[model samples]
Target: MTGFVYSESYLNHITGTGHPESPDRLKAIADHVRNSEYWNSLKSIKPNVISTNIIQLIHSGSYINSVSEACENGFPFLDFGDTAICRESYSVAKLAVGGVVQAVDEIFNGNLDNAFCAVRPPGHHAEAESAMGFCLFNNVAIAAKYAQKKYNIEKVLILDWDVHHGNGTQHIFDSDPTVFYLSLHQYPFYPGTGSKNETGTGDGLGATKNFPLSAGSGDKEYMDIFENILPEIVIQYSPSLIILSAGFDAHYRDPIANMNVSEESFSRMTKIVVKLSREVCEGKLISVLEGGYDLNALVSSVEHHLKALQGN
Candidate 1:
């Protein structure tokens, strides 16, 4: 199997107690990666620092500055509801963003065939100006813009499989034709945005595809959509690269959300995505870990996710 990239600072370790988004989630991932034989495929690497100027490619100064201010003034909630920040949160979030950007660069430069970012403060729910659902920075979006600006790649595909819709990601790219945002998640959930009719608008019309399955939808329904819809739309778009907002909270054992996506589903799903990347983009794929509350489920699912990613 081809070697991959990961990092230790991905283990930021400072959210709050039993806060659905806790450090333990990443700790479990780190521990498993260390114990598993598959760990050999992953080498620890540092992010190539992209400046605030580079970050501005996706986020506004106000949003970036405000989060920094909140970290300075003291820990305050960043989300409208659940997300919060402590003193170290800002620094750790930087590492998280760095991890994604580095993963993007490594894949684009052929240092690794593909990479999975094991960082936290997950980014899909983070928008251009607001942080929501535990996300402080839009990691995947920043990578998308970096790819477009630096590589001159015209089309990038973002696939959100987080059990909840990536309203923030969609809103950020809804008007841009150069990026395609596709989400397959539970309908009528938190942030409540994805729907069958809520496809992309303006120049991005038909680019944003949503498959909002019912609350109890399990591997069967999820797999059905992936086999048919995901490949068809993505192949049509013919993305230069595929970025995954990979969230494991959809697993049946997760405490926060209740979709029945098991560990096997994660591996199988990754297999399909890799298949698409191979077919069209020569396998330029990068995945960033997102929302997953249950520690056991998160660990198990992420392990499966990486195994499939490594073609192990």
Candidate 2:
């Protein structure tokens, strides 16, 4: 069974009106899953209380404090543009990270082969010291570091399929050879990072890979990249765990970005990842929600993702 980690607090991280990253995003997924046929197959779990020190593993102390202070003092946005935070955002963001960490623990403890975290205020765009692109804390990055620190996981592979490149995640692990960050996002897009030439640096050379697809690229292009490039890399790296930054914004129905991927395509990608995980890492895998703005597309896409995660 695939564990599903979520919490009601996620809806409280308010972004106000007219923001794409609103509370409705999570609600849509929640409603759809509860009413779906695969709902019973999922083992739902609530997020645990995450400690501040654990969060410090991925973000600096000063930066962490700054976020807390901003939330306490009621700031509308963070230092960078587009990262909106309310008074409850800091606490709720920690819960989001907690969800991912809990999923990692469940996977490593033999409780589940894989899990998916349905979280909001997406984290892939949040850097170590700053928040941007509607993220306050880097959830998946913190979970990767936590798996390393607590479970002695030597290598973690982060596969980000968000429409916008996970610039923040790439920045955090750019110099670390232990973590391999691969992102396939829209090129010349928002935040303007994730160029093909921007591989890793220092000891982490070639650890970072980016495949910036065109705006209208669809299933054929995405599947070709995954089938051709990802398998070889996963087999060679042999990571201790695989983490997916699953984003449904690439769906053709999504208004945020211009990709033509379908829900069925997400299933194929999940199956490929599952097969690779089985071959390389004892079937250990976990995924966290990132960017998926269109309500209908996000709901249907997550359902398909969960079906694949459940090995159906």
Candidate 3:
């Protein structure tokens, strides 16, 4: 069975009015999933609030404190302006990380084959010391650390297809061979990272891989890499668990990004990952939401993704 990790409290992050990373993103997905055919078949799970101590696995203590203080003092944004927050944002971000960690626990315990964490304020952008790109805390990064520490997992493969390169996740594990970070994103894009030459350093020298695609690239381009390039790298890495930073902003309908990918491509890509996880890691995989701006596109793309996750 596929586990769906979420919490109503995730809606309480409150990025603000007119923000692309608004609560409506999750609401739209939640609404559609509940009304869709997969609701009953998918296991529903509410995330518990993880302690700040767990968050320190990925974020520095001072940075975590600053986020709390900023929210408590009613700062409008965590960074210059993109990452908006409210009093509940710090706690909500914790819940988002917790959701991913809980999914890890569930998969390890064999309660579910895999999971998709429908959470926000979307991570993969937040760094160890600062929040960026509408992300307050790095959810997937924390989950990787949590899994390593608790489950004694030796290797993790983080596949980020977020349109924007997951600079935060990449940098966090830039030198750690235990976590391999692979990304396929628009090059020369926002956050200004993820170049072909920016592979990992030191012990992680070859663990980081990036496939930078051009604008207007659609299904054929993405599929070429997924079918030809991705499988080889993933099979060789042979991680203990797979984590996907599943972002749908590459959809043709999304406003914030420029890519021509459709929902079918998302499903196809998910299926590839699912098959890879099953082969390489006994189907131990977890997908965490990152960015999908257009509400309709988000809903449709997520539906396709979840269905693929269910092996439908």
Candidate 4:
């Protein structure tokens, strides 16, 4: 059955008012999920606090220390960057990573058909040694590494449909052929990393696939790309586990990004992923929340996404 990982501590990673990545994002989704009919059927799991040793799988030691010290000293922001943090952010970020890790473990252990992590301080923009873009650690990236290290998974597929490209994730596994990173995002946008030509490097060449769409691209365009490319890539890669950098910011109502993806589109896209997992990996899949600014849209899109996850 489809399961979910959550923690009230996630709300402690506050970014202040007017900040797009606020605590309410997760709160809205959590409340909606609990009130839904599927609540009784969905397994609710609490994530264990992860070790710094597990974090070292993807982040450098100095960077980890710096983040810890910053949180301890109560630095306003990790850098003179867009990412913001408070006293509890360091621990909360670690918990966010833990949530994804727990999802990976459950899926691999046959306790769940799939899982979703409603986490905060999104991680796609975080690099191996730095925290930026409202992120501390690259949660999904770490989960991918965890799957490889702990589970002996041979090949993993990461599908990111966030409005913005997952630069950190792409770069992390860019030179490793074992992980295939595929992203569909708005081109010529923030952080500006994803491009058609920037496939991969060295042994990882062609393992990374990017489909950069325009700002106004909507459901049809997104689905067209998915139908054309996603299935073919899944068949070619034959991933043992599929991880999603699932961000709802692409919704037309989202404040931070420009895209026209609707609630229905998210379900359709999710159905595609679900079917792919069934074909390629016995339905082993996990989605880690990335970005979504609008509360109502985030909540509704997540409901649709989970409904698809539950095979509803």
Q: Per-candidate TM vs. native?
A: 0.96, 0.98, 0.99, 0.99
Task: Compare the candidates by lDDT and give the number of the best one.
Answer: 3
Tens-place lDDT per residue, model 1, 152-199, is 888999999998899889999998998999998888888789988988
- Kindly list the per-residue Cα lDDT of model 2 for residues 1-312, writing each as its tens digit: 799888888999999898999999999898889888878889998998988998899899999999999999999888654788899999999899889989988988899999999997799988988888888899999989999988997999999999999999999999999999999999989979999998999999999999999889989999998899899999999999999999999999999899999999999999999999999999999999999999999988998899998887
Worst 10 residues of 2 by lDDT: 76-85
Alpha-carbon lDDT of model 4: 0.92
Summarize candidate 3's per-residue lDDT along 1-312 as a digit string, tens digits: 999998889999887678888899998899889898779999998897778989999899999999999989999887887788999999999899889989999999999999999999889988999999989999999989999999998999999999999999999999999999999999889989999998999999999999888888889999999999999999999999999999999999999888999999999999999999999999999999999999999999999999999998
* TM-score of model 1 (CA atoms): 0.96
> In order, what is each prediction's RMSD in angstroms?
1.5, 0.9, 0.7, 0.7
Q: Please give me the total number of clashing residue pairs in predicted model 4.
A: 0
The TM-score, computed over Cα atoms with residue i paired to residue i, of candidate 3 is: 0.99
Q: Model 4, which residues run further than 4 Å from truth?
A: none
Model 4: per-residue Cα lDDT over 1-312, one tens digit each: 988899999999978878888898899999999988889999998988889998999999899999999989988897685779899999999999999999999988999999999888789989998987988999999999999999998999999999999999999999999999999999989879999998999999999999999899999999998788789999889999999999999999988888999999999999999999999999999999999889999999999999999887
lDDT against the true structure, per candidate, is 0.83, 0.92, 0.93, 0.92
Residue 246 in model 3: lDDT: 94
**Model 1 worst lDDT run, 10 consecutive residues:** 1-10
